[model samples]
Target: MKDMVTPTMPVFEDMLAAHDRIAPHIHRTPVLTSAYLNGLSGAELFFKCENFQKAGAFKVRGACNAVFGLDNETARRGVATHSSGNHALSLSYAAGRRGIPCHVVMPRTAPQAKKDAVRGYGGLITECEPSTSSREAVFAEVQAATGAEFVHPYDDPRVIAGQGTCSRELIEQTGGLDAVIAPIGGGGMVSGCCLTLSRLGPGTLIFAAEPEQADDACRSLRAGRIIADDAPETVADGLKVPLKDNTWHFVSRHVTDILTASEQEIVEAMRLAWQRMKIVIEPSSAVALAAILKNPEIFRGKRVGVIVTGGNVDLDRLPWSAG
Candidate 1:
């Protein structure tokens, strides 16, 4: 495993603070182990079930911490963010908890369920062009028009610290993991997960699982640069962002490896998990299982931990299948 950074980043203390700040709002989600999944993957597998988290995904942790940890004046001004789905819902829920209004800038192409969730949670939605470059412009307009504070999706220290608490709880629950694999999109989960493991569980190999079509993180890590995701296409709508500087900054320091999984592999893994394990996993989260299934040798003999990061698959439309 290569050191992803010259100096280990100090994200753990903030994660600890996040754990304390958002403790009452966030769920200490359970760590589930599957004898069948372990045997199938040829490794002892511990699934940190954030799919069961508040907002039905791990986004709420960061969203809650970032929302609640804000000073009263900032909270009073309200908050705004851009997301495909989970982040919007999480932001809405977190803001609702704090008695503040949330403005969510979502891609028009974002899942209808996610859009509905945002509205269901009382979020005010402003639809935008799905591109990263334009989303910022749209958010800026919304923030200015609404006079709302911005809560960045993945690149903020506060949000990243909040996300780290998920992995912290996972490490605490499992105790010893030879390797931990998390699916990466915008790098929030991996950034935080890496920070926690680097500090508390130093020996844990942190692997990032990414969709092959949306393999920007793999490219960014290899090139040590942030690559734009030009005309990206993937079933994992959540894993759409190009790597952020802060995310890549942490990736360079803590990630042990970046693995790519095919669309077919991702779909099959999602189906199998739902049918066999009865776990409804989103395509982004299913990337972890997909990677394990496709390249078993890399993880076969190791004690591996995977974040079943979310369960918010729209259930209306399905991913491409093996048949």
Candidate 2:
């Protein structure tokens, strides 16, 4: 396999540009507060509800930016990417808006709901084994065959800049936050938070949440280098991938800590949000909340921003339900 080229690190200006470019396509998703969750976590939690976003996830912000920023010639051939779910559907949604072909390389084992959503968004799917190697290999073939522009799920600078816009809105929604937390997979959202907050909310502490079963990001932070796991089993399907250089650049520098929650804790958080907060958030989004609940001392007494990354769930297979 050839080395993936690392795009230049995105700056605050790039995030601003991305926000302006994608605003027409994306909703300025609301920030909601839950008194029950606040009382439980002992912190003033503001949930930036990207779950209500277009394509049902925060990935749309990045996907739209990448898809729309393409030149006419490049876009004529359309776009291609490999994602477990959210990014795939998001890119498809964006491409559909532009009336372009969107090819997706998805894991054969990815949630059926996500796969269905991707197809519903008009993305052409080619299934691969649920591993980084298989995903990349399949995506390479798709890209070559179609001659489409490649839009990496989290690693690309365009995607990171687009994701950073979420924090920009969060800082604006809440006057000033003491801290902010979001789930980390390939670290796009966390890196984006770091990118935006490091410049705008310089005083705000940034944290990345992860599942203990897939704690590569936490381990990498402690080890002072990237430690990738090929395929880790966790309920937070969106967080299975490992960090790339571009995302690692921001995460390593600006994130204050990497926290983790167990699988049961993640499911509980997801259920708690649905029951108490009256919102539908996927397991990946719940990791931040679970970490806050698990380590109240870290968030207590602080006005914290919790990114509700996405709402997409496989209703037929709720994690808390018995098989």
Candidate 3:
């Protein structure tokens, strides 16, 4: 088995570099506000609409950084990783732009919309069982066969630095914020928020939102150690992965709290965003809004930045319409 490379912790400077490197490949996603949501939650929320991002998700930021940063020889070999959805498609998008082959190992249970998007962007897929162990095992085989440079979904410094660019844009767009909240799956986006906010907006409180069913990150924060669940199930399919040491470094140090909401709450919030904000966001993206509504005291009267992470939902199987 090829050994996984340990990613170095990213510094604020690295984020700056990543921003410049990936500027051409990504969108400076807009920040939007809804008065009704503000009245309901008592927080002035600025939604960073990464759902409008290229490839339909924020994961492209990290994937672009990893793919573009590679040297010619390494780039020629292509790139590979395992993701539930967003990262897989994001990597494929980035690799396609670079004219390189992208291989991905995704859970068989991942949203079909995401799988289709991956293929649409020219990625070759290898399916695995919906568990971390199976993903790793299958990814190892794919990596060996393809000899692709593995760009781990969230547990990579290049990826984290790339994800940090979202918050950097948030801070610049908002002037400043009292707090920033984003869905935490493998802690990539949250860790990126931590990496950026700690330096650029030191006073900003960083919060991670998660599905109650897949709340290992929340539990890990409380335990003061990593707590991983291999095959946790949740409506926020994109957030089922566990946090790794690379992300845990920022999450453990800078995150003010980790919040969770029930499956029903996430569904309701997803529907509410579509109804009120008229924006299409996935269950994973809705987790942050659900957490804010469930715990209004933490966010009330404050200027909060909410990262609306993605819009890649299976329209035929909307969570709210499920029987």
- TM-scores of the candidates are 0.92, 0.95, 0.95
Report lDDT (CA) for all predictions: 0.85, 0.92, 0.93
Ranking of predictions according to lDDT: 3, 2, 1
Highest lDDT against the true fold, candidate: 3
Which 10-residue span in candidate 2 carries the lowest summed lDDT? 1-10
Q: Can you write out model 3's per-residue Cα lDDT over 97-182, one digit (the tens) per residue?
A: 99999998888997676677889999999999987689888988888787899988888999999999999999999999999999
Regions more than 4 Å wrong, model 3: 1-3, 107-113, 127-137
Give candidate 3's whole-model lDDT.
0.93
lDDT of 2 by residue, 76-168 (tens): 999988765789889999999999999988889977777888899999999999877887889888888888888888989889999999999
Q: Per-residue lDDT of 1-323 in model 1, one digit per residue for the tens?
A: 01211133345788898999999998899888778888898988889999999989999998998899889987998998876578888999999999999998889987677788889998999888878677878988887787787777777777888899998898889887899999998899999988888888899999999999999999988887888787689887688787776688788888988999888888888887887777888989999998998888999889998999899866557775324
RMSD of 3: 1.8
Winner of 1 and 3 under lDDT: 3
> Where does candidate 1 stray beyond 4 Å?
1-10, 107-111, 129-137, 320-323
